[model samples]
Each structure stands twice: as C-alpha cells, then as structure tokens.
Target: MSAPSSVPLVVHVIDQLGIGGLEVVLVNLINNTPTDRYRHAIICLRGATDFKNRITVPGVSIHTLGRRPGKDFSVFRRMWSVLRKLRPAIVHSHNLPTIDMCVPAKLAGVRRLVHSEHGWDISEERGSSRKYNMMRKVLSPLVDRYVPVSKDIETWLRTGVGLPASKVLHIYNGVDTDFFHPAEGNLIPLPAPGFDLANRVVFGTVGRMQTVKDQVNLAKAFVELSRLRPDLMERARLAMIGDGDLKAECESVIAAAGLTDKTWLPGARNDVAELLRGLNVYVLPSISEGISISILEAMSCGLPVAATRVGGNPELVLEGETGLLMPSRDPVALAEALATYMDQPELMQKHGAAGRQRIEQSFSVTSMVNGYLGQYDQLLGRQHP
Candidate 1:
C-alpha cells in the first residue's frame, strides 16, 4: 500500500446519496478503497441521509449542499467553498444533475475533473431531445475525462452528444463477491413481513420504485404469470425492494390484481446481500439501466437473473447462460421468462452457478477499485509529468 503522501485527495460529487445504484457504488468505493492510496470525501448537492453511515473509513469527510426543492444558486457557491477548502486532486461527479459540479470544480482550480454517466433519467430517454443534447455539448468541455458505466453510454456520448471517443472510458459497475455471496446452507432470513420463505419460491428484485425502473411492469408481469399459471400461486411470491414516487401506484396495482398475499413491497433495503440470498430467483424489470449493481449483487449471491435487455444489462447477464434477458416493457415476455425458471429447478441452479462464476471471473469489487485507481494514476501522471 502506498503512503498517504502518495495518495491524492479524491472527492465524489452526487445529487443525493439516497438508496439507488449510483449511491451503492459510491458507498462501495469509499468503503472498499485503501485509505493509503486514496483519501476520499463525498459531496451531496441535496443533502445526505443515514446512508453516510455505510462509509466505514475514518477521516473521510462528507459535505451536503442542503439545496431546497427548486433551483439553488447557493449549490455552486457551496461547492466552490468546499473545493477551495479541501483542494482535492480530482472532483468526480456522477450523472447529469451532479455533472454541473465540474464547472465549480474547474473554477476552484481542481486539476482533474471526471464525470460518470450512470444512466439516462426518464426525461432524457424520450429520444435525445435537442435541449438536453445542447446542454451536454455546452458542459462537455468542463470535464477532463468521461466515465460511462456502459458501452451504450459511451456510444451515446460519441454519436448522440458528439463527445470525443478518446476521452470516454467504459467501466462496468462491480459487486462485492465476498459480501454478496450465496448464503451458506439453505435457510435465509427475510428482511420484511408478508414474505414467508418456507412455502414459497421467492422471486425478488431490488431497485428504486420509479418510472424509469418500471416496477409497475414487474407487478403486471407477476399478476399475468399468476393468472396464467394458478399452480405457481401456491408456491411463488414477489419481493419488490426499494421505495420511490411510484410505490403507492405499484401497491394499488397489486391490490387490483388480487396479488396482495403473493407480493410484498418492502421499500428500500440496506441488507441487499442477505435479501438477495433469501430469494430463489432475481429479476430486474427496468425500462433503462446502466450495469445495475443490484443485478451484479444478485448474480454474486448465486441467484439466476431475469433482466430487461436495455443499457448495460446485456453486458452483465449472458442471456440463457447466466440468466434470461427479455425485451423491456414487455409483460408477457417477462412473465414467460419468470415462468421458465419456476418450471425448471435444475436450469435455475445451472444458470445461477454460471452467473456466480461470471462475477468472480470478471466483475469482482477489487477489479473495479483497481480500474478506477488506474485511471486516477494515469490522469495524475500526465498532469505531473
């Protein structure tokens, strides 16, 4: 391990460190990274929650902008103040809302600025809209390096946003295999009520209950599956994790479908690895994704995945090998895929084993941390030399 003197002060800027894929990645980076090689800090534009407690590293500072609901100019002023005081070597911003931090970071004399594109939000997914593309173009110069979590994102930056391919680097999100591995023995603990593991084949998914994630579609698919195969009603159950604007809407759908007993909406969960192990199969019915960390965690837990074919999901799940990949927003396809696993027990075991092997070989947390460290070293070397 390199000494603290050799390490640079790296600060991460995010919109809100809430319960989501990006937040999980940020937490993992702070927790798993060696302090000897990287002194880290986090800045949340709209304040942070108990999620900050997840970072176990000592001496890591966290600053929240405390911006209100509307547009706040004070965010920029606060960012500048923090940057000036900390004098970080790199200001790494994630997603679009936080991307604006690069401007203040640049103004504050931060030497290197890195912007990571996790995925497109609902508004950006409505076919490239000229206004958003223009904004990206205007802000493109502020970032020194673009870190896109998927190849699709890199392609978008190059073709859609007209960013240089040379500056864009593709880095897939990783999962902690040790922390999220398959549960020993057979008994797994349930984190919420209404989920009885003794008599049901638990089908679970972890994601924000938002429009982009499309939890409504997952509910529709589950209800359709129950209608088609009444036998599964006796053995199958749905566990929808995470909470968002659409939770009440999703609950209403479940009630209408008469799946109140078969489905459980436990909101956002902190013990993801344990929750993943409690399930027999893992599913991600997202309309869009950028290498979902939940999918990786599930795969690492030795659970077969059934994910929508969008964004970086295809790269993580190898279709029939690791898990099945169905078209996005298609309830029939999603239900059919889920039904296949329900009918075939051996297939689930085979696919789940393959998924675990894939994660161990390619997507380990160590590899991800080292990849970011390599990028930091390369950028710093170029600056100093």
Candidate 2:
C-alpha cells in the first residue's frame, strides 16, 4: 500500500541526535532513501543535535523540544504542535523514549505510526520495567509496524514487550562497503603517532565511551594482556576511539594499569572508515547491542573482530570464523580473546577476509535501505489507500 502524495513527509523521532549506532543508522537511512518520493525530518526529544551534520539530504528540518530531564510531559505539547504543523504522512520513532510521541501523533490524526527498538541502554538493561512494558502494551495499537534491529529484540518485543509476532519486523543494520572497505596503504594517519602500524598489531574499538559500551572493560583487558605478554608489547597497541562522559574513567583505568603510553584514546572521529583501515583488528566492548554498525563497518573494512557474546553480537561475529566472542564485563575473558588474535596473526587475515565476504553476502547498505523503504511503502498504502 503506497500513499498517493507526490512527496510524503516522514517524521523521525528520537531521544537525541548524538553519536551511537542507532543515530548512525538513521543518517544512513536518510541519505540512502529515495528523495523524490519521500521527505524526511527529525524531532529530538532531549535536543543533543551534535550529529546533525551527518545528514546530507537537503531540506530535512531538525527540531529540538528541549525537554527537561525526569519524566517531562510538557515535551508532548511541543511534539503535538510540531505534528499539527508538519502533518507528516508517517511518524517513525526510534528507541523507547520517542515511542510516547505516538500518543500525540495519533491525537494529531497521523494514521501511519512506526516504531523501532535499537536495544536497551544502561537503565533498562536487564529488560523493560513493569510500568514501561504496560505502557508499551497500552500504546501498541498506535504503532502500525514495529522494526527491531535484531532477532533478540524481536523476541523481546514479542514476549517481553507483548507485541505480536506479525507486527515485529527484524532488520539488521548495514554498512557502506564502498566507504569502509579495506585500506590500501594507511590512507588515514593514525591518531597515536610513533607507533609503527606495519609492525604493530593495532587492536581498536570505536563507540561512545559510555557505561553501557563498557570501554573501561576493554582498557582493563588490554592492560592485563600487556602484563601477560610483555614480549608482544612491541607488536601490539590499543586504540579506543570516540568520546563521552566515561572517557575519563577509561583514561584512569589505562593509566592505573601503566598503559597510558600503550593505548590511544582519540575521542570522536569523523573519518571512521579511514580510521577502520588503519587498524589490524576491530573490537566491540559493548555491554549490549542491536547488531552494531561499528562491527559491520569493521567487517566491511576486512578487519577481524573480538566482541562480547551479548545482544546481537553472536549473530554478527561467528566464533572462530569471523571473530571470537567472550562473556561481557569480564576483563580476563576479553584478554584471552584478544590474546588469541595477538598470537595467531594469520587467523586475523583469514577471519578478516571472511568478515568482508559475510558483509557482501548479507549485510550491504542497499539491503537495509530497501528493507526500511518496503516498510514505509507498506505503511503508506495501508493508511492512504
């Protein structure tokens, strides 16, 4: 069912437009989606609009409600006003907080409502609260389609959140292979100078240095690995890219472990694809995920990975084939996994090649963009026709 509007507007709602896998995917979605048929706009609830530069599509308006922290209902009034003004053909919200905008959207007479779950944050880590789950179930009728980025989340939606199986559409985040493919010869300079990339086995991970990401754990593991294998110190280095509140904590851990010189924390980077090329191995030290775009980008760049077994990481990282997976929050287990790659450098090439092949076979950006477009078309046809 496709809507008849010449260019139907789609309003995307989220808590913040900051750095994260979810925000990255949204940028990719907007950039790749056909512009002639659809117009897109963003509404940020908490107003972290630092990543707006990522949006390349022209005329895509960004709005911030400036909602105060701690259960702000006044944001809904602002959202309602925005809905009335835009009159979007579709209201698509991401994550948990923005889902409430569906209430105002429905009241504003927007028929097409779509919601996506990008996995839990530190707060609702174990699962959604009883009150939150009940609220979701109550608002379930307002959502025309529910897109969960992984099968794990699809199950959570179906059983835990009480969403019907038919309503949940599982879509894995995709990577732009053209932009993130393997480096030719250090096209991007390393942030940490004096380290020899040709000789050193650079192990790196890119993400916001937040509690849920558990970058401190990666720092600890790297320090332990350094202690366990002093001989490999000349050949191994660690890079923790991206920045957040927990960055100081990561620095403290590295310093305490006597690894301040061994590790490089370069804060947030714009040239991630080039940065991915500079590393021999990629790591995802997240406590939770919904098919991480960073892991996919690393694979696309032909870099072998060492990630936790939590969330959708197992779905992406095949044990011993593409990369090794260890238990979450355990520095010892993480160190052991990193040690395997450090010792068996030959495995790095094999797994790195396999990872790129995997990306080409199933996780290309085209496939992900098409999946979202198909859902949009379905929602439009259902609502307008």
Candidate 3:
C-alpha cells in the first residue's frame, strides 16, 4: 500500500540505515503496519546505506541530513527544517543519536514524540552516564512515550536514566516465523565459491562486524575449537554473514589459524533467511544487545543458538532449552559451547526445534506489530478498530 496523507505520519529517525538488528526491526515494523492506518517516513541523521531498499512498503520517503563529523551543530538546523516540512504527527526516534532531534521535532510542532532505545551507543554505557542521563532528563518533557525493546532497557531508562516510570513501555522484537521456517530437504548452495557445508556442522551468525557485536570474538572462538579438539574442528565449519569495520579483523583471525578454507564470510547478503537455513547452528557473540532481530530470525529458521550472556541475550536464549549462552569477550566459553553442540547431534536438533516453538509462541511478527500499534493508538488517543 502507498502512503495516504489522510492518516497520521510517523517519522522514524535513526543515525543510519546500517545492516543491523535495529534496521531490520524498523523495516519489519514499517512493512507490517497497515499503510492505510499510518503513513511512514524515514529520516537518517547522517546518511542511509543500501539497506534502505529493504523498506518494501511504497510511498514512504527517506531523507538524509548530511551530518558533519564531531558535534555538527548545523545538523540540528537541517533536521529542524526537515521536521517543519514533514510536520509529522509522531516523530518516533531510535536510540540516543536521534534523541537530540526530539527537541527539534517538538519545536516544529510535532503532536506526539516517541523514542526507542534499540541498544546502547558504541561509547555510551547502558543509561548509566551522569552527563547523558542529565541530557535525557532535560529533554524528557518533549517526549510523549519511551519504548525500550527489552525489559532490561526499560529498567535502565526508569531506574538508571530516570525517565518517568509510566511512560516507559517494553516491546519485544519479533520474527516472521512463516517466512523464516526450517529448511526443506533441499538447501541452497553457499554464496561463496567452492565453500560447501556437506558432511560438516556449519555454525554461523548474521550481524554487522562491529566492536559491540564482537564477531571477531566468534571467529577467534572457531580457531580455539581447533586447538581444543582438532577432531571436532575438522567436522565444524564457520559462516559469518554481514560486513562492517571489523570484517577485516575477523578474516585475519580465521586466516591466521589456517581455517580460511573451512570458514566462509560472504560479506553481507539480502537473503539472510536462505543463509540461515543452510546453517546447522546459529551464533550471536555480541558484547551487547537489545532484543536482537538476528537471534529471533535464526531461531525462527529452526537453528540451535550459541549466544553471549549480555544485555537482552539472557532474556531471549533460554539456557538448556532453546540455546546456550557464554560470557562476553570469552572465546574459550564460546568454543566450548560450540563443541558441546557438535558432540551431540540429537541435542542440537532438540534445541533447534524448541527455539522454533518459542518464536511462534512468544516472538511472532503479529505480537510485535500489535504491541507497537497498541502503543501508537493509546498515545494518539485513537481507538483501534
């Protein structure tokens, strides 16, 4: 459906359209929301990447501010001008980078303001910094509601960041179970040339290779698996999707360990569902997280998971059930977890099956879209039909 100006417009503000969990959540929310009920627009604070093409719903416009580096005060002026032209009914911003613009949104006569903390900034602690919390407190009056993607973040905003308790609402990021189901007998070939998963247990993950994501750690863990038990490592192969600043570093780690032939880094691909299907197990070795869309998507694809115990990872991965968790920055723990799953094929299958059931029961797209719709309806005082 195309955008209809007759309905309210929600301007989703973010730092960039990077290929990450938050971007996936934004695309899912916009595509799933009924276009007749609310028209949507995206405002990138700095710029947008090719990831913007994922927005399938038509008539949704995207604007960029061309922000300069290190305290570009003029970006605010540019954003203010954009807000004036859009005159959005609800300026829904994501994360701290877009929080400053809520003031500009309110000044430009926006009706309601909503902000969601998808995850912590690269530098910012989890709502614990005194200086940053002070800024959020000062601008709290301008925001109508604060939607955190996890209960952990909800606590940080209320008790740590000191936002109003009543205004803080928690929402879980969801996956399309129908779209990301278990693979049939026929699995697609890998994107990388001559890299086959035949007779090997392929443990993989899909995310931006950044410091916070700690994909490099996962690569190092794959090497450690070789050292701990070469027999198991011979049967194991690693495939990490997505690309970023740390991609080169991850490559170096795998190459140095002489596992380049056994590992596949396909950079970034749009067909994440197909890629997930080809994997026997999913891994999320992030240093931090907030209701990761990748984990949900992987689980929906019926892949057993091995994720780090940080941020919202614990909340998502049920220990001894759906997936196993390791402490962040510890490659040994991750390597051990991978070995355990590889040692027991039946256990891996059991976990993968349970993960799919969990996604259907608790993390379906309908639940996520409904949660946001309910919040929007109540905030705007519009009754839901």
**In candidate 3, which residue pairs get closer than 3 Å at backbone N, Cα or C atoms, i.e. clash?**
none
lDDT of each: 0.86, 0.88, 0.88
Pairs with steric clashes in candidate 1 = 242-267
Query: Model 3: per-residue lDDT, tens digit, 296-353?
Result: 9999988889999988888888999999998989999999999999999898899999
Q: Which stretches of candidate 3 lie over 4 Å from their true place?
A: 1-3, 186-189, 192-197
Cα-based TM-score, every candidate: 0.94, 0.95, 0.96
Name the 10 consecutive residues with the lowest summed lDDT in model 1: 187-196
Is candidate 2 or 3 superior in TM-score?
A: 3
* Error of model 2, residue 68, in angstroms: 0.6
Candidate closer to the true structure by lDDT (higher is better), 1 or 3 = 3
Once fitted onto the true fold, the runs of candidate 2 whose alpha carbons sit more than 4 angstroms away are 1-5, 185-189, 382-385
Quick one: how many clashes does candidate 1 have?
1
lDDT of 2 at 128: 63
Clashes of each: 1, 2, 0
Q: lDDT (0-100) at residue 35 of candidate 2? A: 79
lDDT of 3 at 157: 91
